[model samples]
Target: MAFGSDRRDPYRAVRLKLFVIQVGALLAIWLVLLSIVYVLMSSELYRVLDSELRRSAIQVIQSYDHNHLSTQNANNQSDFGAAYSLWKITGAASSMSATYIDGTPFIDVRTVYHNALMHPSGYSTTLQINGQPYRIFDALVNLRHGTYLIQVDRSVGPTQVTLSSLISTLIIAGMAALILTLVGGLILTARSMKPLLASWRQQQQFIADASHELRTPFAIIRSNLDVLLHHPDHTIESEMTYLGNAYEEVERTSALLENLLTLARADSNEQILNLSPVSLGELARDVVESTRPLAEWQQKTITLNAPENHCMVIGDPARLRQLLLILIDNALRYSDAGACVAITISCDTTSCELRVQDNGAGIPQNLLPRIFDRFVRADPSRHRAEQGSGLGLAIAKWIIEAHKGQVFVQSKEGRGTTFTVIFPS
Candidate 1:
């Protein structure tokens, strides 16, 4: 059982969901990013190519002199950035220059004539060179001597290869990042839920054990009290005195069981709540009035503070009233004689708040967290003869939580304690 309990397996369904979502989002972002990169890089490449082509065309035209004297001097200039083939005409005669690399001319004689028709403006086209493609830009210029045509070509091979490689890299990196994120998130979620799962199991065990413990003691006490009463010599006063203690313990056990049942019912997700709009002012007034007699018996003063007009909240009225009674009862049990306990109802346009503040020996700091835990008491060693079944605060918390409201406590040792409940609009 221990080995089986400790075995760990991946939560595959949740992990798969996370992986798909993360990867899908990353894939979309990468696609957009790669598209933008492609567009911007392509534009910048074209701009640089345009400038280079214009410069090369100007350099080629300057190679000839005003006398129309062609010089071999242009050959030694090393002006052509890349090997290119060129053809030129002087009157009815023609001359040509070819690179030793034996590459086909990117701009042909026919393209130059087309540029001449267009005049000044350039024309661009692609041509094959040594089985590789190059982009060519040709311009026609009417030089002082004669008509001259200049052309430039740039290799597209390296730029295309680089862009394709980068896109592939980005896609691979995005997918890897997505996988790692899903794995990490799944592990974190499981770790976070571990403590809560342990607590739930402990609560289940506690309920089972507490039920058996309570039943035995109660049954024993009741049987003993009954035997004592069956004797003929037993007096009414003695029976009442002795039997009262046993009867009170039984009531305590009953209250504990009742609280557990209420919590069980409340935990059922299918439990239908009797919901209605309740007046906060009226509820506070009624709870205060009902507990007035108990306050007098305990020699404590009870004060109510609420607006004259109705302040409404949406919830189960019976549950709200029960929660109020629990808070007042808890305050009365701990409050010092003659100390004042105030119940205040404050409201705004959107929500309402109820505060019960008591001038009492405030709860110990360490016990504050478990104040709403079943069967947990601040002073466990103290006699339960008159103290409650230790379920009032627990019930109050469950009831408030059921209404989608929050309950909180503020306490300072030996100063006072305040319990606040809030209901949304």
Candidate 2:
């Protein structure tokens, strides 16, 4: 079992612990509430029964008349559920007594009368009479020419039944609530862990990719340094080639580290956008003009398509400029020699649209969904040759999303790729 358990998912134990805590807390609260309700209900029911008994005993004593001393019996309980017994004791002798009883067939007459004489003017909160529970009250009254003891008995069977039913209902309800709490706790914990697990896995992937990318430039720098070390006695000009090669690798490494820092700041929400009104058309025009020289040097052409007037949007100008450059760079990198890269900006009252279209070796259909994910590249070999860390599109995506804009890409292998961006105006 130990070996088998060890092979199971580590999260299972943690998840089970959470489930237990959630369900146990809910069950404890339910039991406490149930106990409180039961106590209140039973207390109220018994209080009513006790009050009725006392009231009936008082009424029986008040209706007693000296003029009716010769009356054999008065049936006071003919209209109520309770039974009554009235005894008149004269001179402390058993033979000199008159008794009147009603609806007390289940009671022991002689014993109850004797008890009434001994414990006069009090309540028997619970008394067993012929195998049933009863609430009995006794009152001793002294009037003209007589001493009388009055007894009132009310059965507690109905109250017992109601309390029993209430307890049974609480038990069933508690069980049902426990089941629901278990199921609900499992569902809630699973849902809560989803984003956390995704973030943890993403962080792991980012670290691995960063290490792999960093190792390449470091290896190149080490090789160049090894060459300079071999020619230790040479002049500065003789070893300048090795020094320049090492410097280029250092520059690439610095750029890669800077890009990683920017992404890290973006992920941690530390890179706050400096928002302002900017002209999209003007920005696109400037980026195209500045990048035209590089395109011509690489045997490619660049053009801008936009309205002559302003296409204003709320965004960070610097971030928008970076975003435009990343897309234009990707278009140029992937296009064949002599291919033309086009930038278009248009706007309406509600939204502004920008497009970077290129006739190049476009992305595969299967890779479109996660193309903006960090470290995801369309062609790993080609990107590595161009010193791409595959973070440009990812950074561009973050910039657009931070500015409350949306990006969409449509591409087909060997045909073309068009990136459409929409910014709220």
Candidate 3:
């Protein structure tokens, strides 16, 4: 059951959710972007069409300077020479001249505009004649005697072709972006989760180690108690002392087991944090005070440089306090005699930061990155002897991460180490 439950699928429900989110977001953004491009490009296309219509209208009006309306009026009737739509308003009476050019023929219309009233300067519209489309440019050119309606029509083959090409390009680009986003998002999600998978495997190994470690202490305590039971008549003071020591060892082992269990729950993301606004300065002060005796016992000087005013941040106060204690306790354990351990709490509008600096026999440069990893101890033997199960910093890291915060360390081999905790405000 344990192994089966841990076997995660790549296409799990959570991954599906991520895929949907990424694809939907990308598609929506692309749609909006394409829509904007289409609108702007379409507007520009219409402007070019309108400009050509205006230029054509000016040329056509200039072509007919002489009074040949009557002569051209008779030519309007003939299938061999098709008619074009032209309007001439001589006072209130208007005359339409229909002329044909090549195979294209035009209809006579009184209105200067296509759909609405055509502007006096120029207007353009789509016209269909004999199952062929034409872009018509119309204008009301004012001459000395009367107003002449000039129209110049141009076929929109090139513009339509260009628009078609643009649409194809947009579709291809959108598809490529979507495919890249899906593939890249999946790869990134997998990479992000790799550390979590590694941590889980390490935790399984730690549990096995912890079980063995716990059994040895329990066996020793049990055997010592059994020996005391058999020698009822001989109540040696040394035996009583031995029993007391065994009980203490049993208590220590129990505490270690409890810490391990807590770590396990934290790793599984089962421990829900009771988050609230916490006074970072006050928390640091309390932790510093609590660890003062430990520091003094080790002949180390513990200094607290908490803010004068309360530095508030949103977090689980208890967990934050635990993190502070873990860092301080670690410094005290590893630091040289009479070394200075400084704790500072600072805050801004966006975040609050807690820095714990110690002039300890600092961590090695290479091991600095893995210091927060579970069961990774700087000095394994001393860590065990100091009752440090090498899980303190790891637990601290988990708790900080649960609060959407971070824990990072900077260390110089011989100089000192500084652990920084950042929490969003």
lDDT of every model, 2 decimals: 0.71, 0.81, 0.71
Best-to-worst ranking by lDDT:
2, 3, 1
What candidate 3 gets wrong by more than 4 Å, as runs, is 1-200, 226-230
Reference-based lDDT, residue 120, model 2: 55
Give the range of the ten consecutive residues with the poorest summed lDDT in model 2: 1-10
Q: What is candidate 1's lDDT per residue for 144-223, written digit by digit as tens?
A: 75565556677877666766786687668657755765565556555555665565666766676577658765786878
| Candidate 2 lDDT, 1-425, residue by residue in tens | 12125343446566667667877888888889999999999999898888888787666666655242224344447235577777665655375454553333444545665776676566566888779998787766676747766678789999999999999998899889888877788787777656765776788899999999889889988998998788788888988888897888888888889999999999899998889999999899889989999999999999999998899999999999999999999999888898999888999999999999999989999999988988888876674557377899999999999989999999999987999999999
Clash pairs, model 3 backbone? 82-99, 82-100, 83-99, 83-100, 84-99, 113-118
- Top lDDT model: 2
- Residue 412, candidate 1: alpha-carbon lDDT: 83
Clashes of 2: 0
Structural similarity to truth (TM-score) of each candidate = 0.55, 0.78, 0.53
Model 2 residue 276 lDDT score? 92
lDDT per residue for candidate 3 within 1-425, as digits (tens), equals 11124444433455456656766777788889987887788778868876766654554455455542343544442221223345554444344443332212344545443322445456667877567776776666677746666656666667778788888988898889778777776676566556756665676778777877778778878888888888888767758776886877778787677778888787577897888888989888877778888778888898888778888987887888888888888888787788999988888888889898988788988898789876677865464457466778888888888888988789997788999989888
